[model samples]
Target: MQEGVIVKALSGFYYVEDGQTIRMCRARGVFKKKGIIPLVGDKVTYTPIGTREGVIEEILARRVELVRPPIANVDQVLLVFSVKEPELNLWLLDRILVHTERARLPGVILFTKSDLLENGDECQLWVSAYEKLGYPVLMVSSRTGEGIEDVRSLVNGKISVVAGQSGVGKSSLLNQLSPELRLKSAEVSHKHGRGRHTTRHVELLRLASRTYVADSPGFSQLEFGDMEPEELAACFREIFELGQQCLYRGCLHETEEGCAVRPAAQEGRMAPWRYQNYLEFLSELKDMKERRF
Candidate 1:
């Protein structure tokens, strides 16, 4: 048996890369009996059948798992957003970031299409704001190769997943990093102002030894699954850190008296947009909870 990582799973087939090459494989039937579905990024051992094929013998332990798009053992979330084409949607960005926080995964913000921005003021402001919130933020133009190396350094030896609005250059970024990928890309619809879905499935593409990246389907709609309304605060890094300043216990930061978060947002201490997005999300969660009953 040889040890390898499952890089792609499609139509009951898994592509496991053992560093030398990616071997097409199928999981043991026992896994299906036990309800053990394999996912990309899962480390496993398999028995080689011939020169380039094998059967997955076992799936090793997973470090972390993501519900939406269903990938496992992800080390980081690459939040790719385009600045121009479809325009930057801060609401969607914050929405996804909140989910990342909920999963306790480090979210890296990569703003694509830097070439469209005539100036860096907006990106710099966003960078300064989000970076202060403990998320590493970067601006890159795949067309110009600006800040591509910085991105390369970030995902050098890690299993990072690329996510963002469609046509935001998720595939383009990966293509730039590893041109060998030649991943298909589409243009953002001029009429609808959103890119058509190019990536239909999740597959991990290897960039270097021990380094892989998964360009999953882009997501514009994400729901907070099974998370309580009160759990939203801890997901926002700024809220989690500044929440310690709340005067009262069990404070939801919405209606609590002497709550530090509202005042901090009111006083420009914390980014107002972050707090506002939190309120919006909290409202959505509350609405969902009410609908449940």
Candidate 2:
């Protein structure tokens, strides 16, 4: 049996790369019987049928799994945002970070289109805010090639899910990294100030040994998905740290007496936007929980 990673899923076929060549393969009937769906980025073992075909025999256990785009064994989430042309959406970026934390994965944020940025202080402020939470943030421009090598270094030995809203230079950055990819990219619309959906499916593209990125479709909406209200604080780094200091055992940090988190937010110890986003997410989770009853 040959061991490989599933690079793409189309129709019902899987294309696996075994460090040499890609082979089109189909999963075994038993997998469907077991309610198993092989996704892109899965490390699997398969049996060859002929020169260019094979049958997937077994799927290895995954390190991580995502539901929206449906990928597996991802080491990190690469959050991409643009400085202009459908400008930076910190709200959306924070939302994605919460989901990333919920998935128990590390995330790095990249501000794309650095060339269009006229005010570096605003970018630095954002960078400082997120960096304080232990996330690596970079300002990158595909046109100017600034921070391109840094991005390459960050993802050199990891499997990252490239995600963001459309027209944020997600695909363009990859193209600049390696022109051979030639991934389709669309420009932001002048009318709506949003980008057209350029990526339609999930596929893992190899960059280096053990370095693969799952280029999935751009999306603007993501649900917390089975996450509990009380468990939300743990998804935000600073809030999780401050929860230990709360006098109440189950403090939600909203109007609770002796809540260290609220005071910190009020004192500007944490970025105001982050605390606001946390409250928004917390409220969302509570609403969802209430509706379940």
Candidate 3:
């Protein structure tokens, strides 16, 4: 028996890495009987059947799991977005951040193509705003090699999931960080204003010793799953914090009387766009609840 991590799953086979070598593996029949399906990023114990093949006998406990891409033990999510090209969709960014918060995963915002921005005043504004809200923000350009080292330092010794809209340069950045990866990348379509989906599936690539990153398939929209309307505000850190001072208990922070969060947004103490997104999400969640019954 040996201990290793399952780095990739393909066509009913799992490729497990045991530091020295990778072994093609299959999960034990007991796991299927017990309704257990192995996922990439799962740590497991396996028995070597041959030089390069094995059987996974036991699955170690998982630290975390993401539903959309279905990867496990994720340490953080690098939410990449382009400052140009497709343009910065802050609404989309905020929606993803809310999901990350609900999953209890740390998320870093990476604005790609810094070199393409002729006037970065708007980009700088967004960076400052997110940073003020205590989220790690990095402006990276794979072509110019800017902010690559900062990204490397952040994902060091952690299992990171690189995710965002298509054409935000996720694959390019991964290639820049780890050239050996040679991950496929595509240009954004000028007609559609979106990047073609180059990454077909999720596979963790080791960038450094004990540091793994997964380049996930790009997605533009996501639906909230089984979350209450009241829980939405808590996902926004600044809103949740300021909401404590609201005069009324159980305030949804949407035009409520004496709402501290609304006042903070009005006074420029909080990002108004983010606050507006919060209200939008709150409304969406409310509508979802109404549709449930």
Worst 10 residues of 1 by lDDT: 118-127
Candidate 1 lDDT by residue in tens digits, 178-270: 999999999888999988998887788899888899888744568787789889988888887888989987777887888989999999998
The clash numbers for all candidates, in the given order, read 0, 0, 0
User: Highest lDDT: which candidate?
Assistant: 3
lDDT of candidate 3 at residue 101, scale 0 to 100:
92
TM-score of each: 0.96, 0.95, 0.96
Candidate 1, superposed: residue stretches over 4 Å from native: none
Off by over 4 Å in 3: none
Model 2: lDDT of residue 88 = 86
Question: How high is the lDDT of residue 149 in model 1?
Answer: 96
- TM-score preference between candidates 2 and 3, better one: 3
Give the CA lDDT, 0 to 100, for residue 209 in model 3: 78
lDDT of each: 0.88, 0.89, 0.90
Candidate 3 clashes between residue pairs 3 or more apart in a chain or in different chains: none
Please, what are the lDDT tens digits per residue for candidate 2 over residues 229-261? 898898889999988999999999999998999
What is the lDDT, from 0 to 100, of the residue 61 in candidate 1? 94
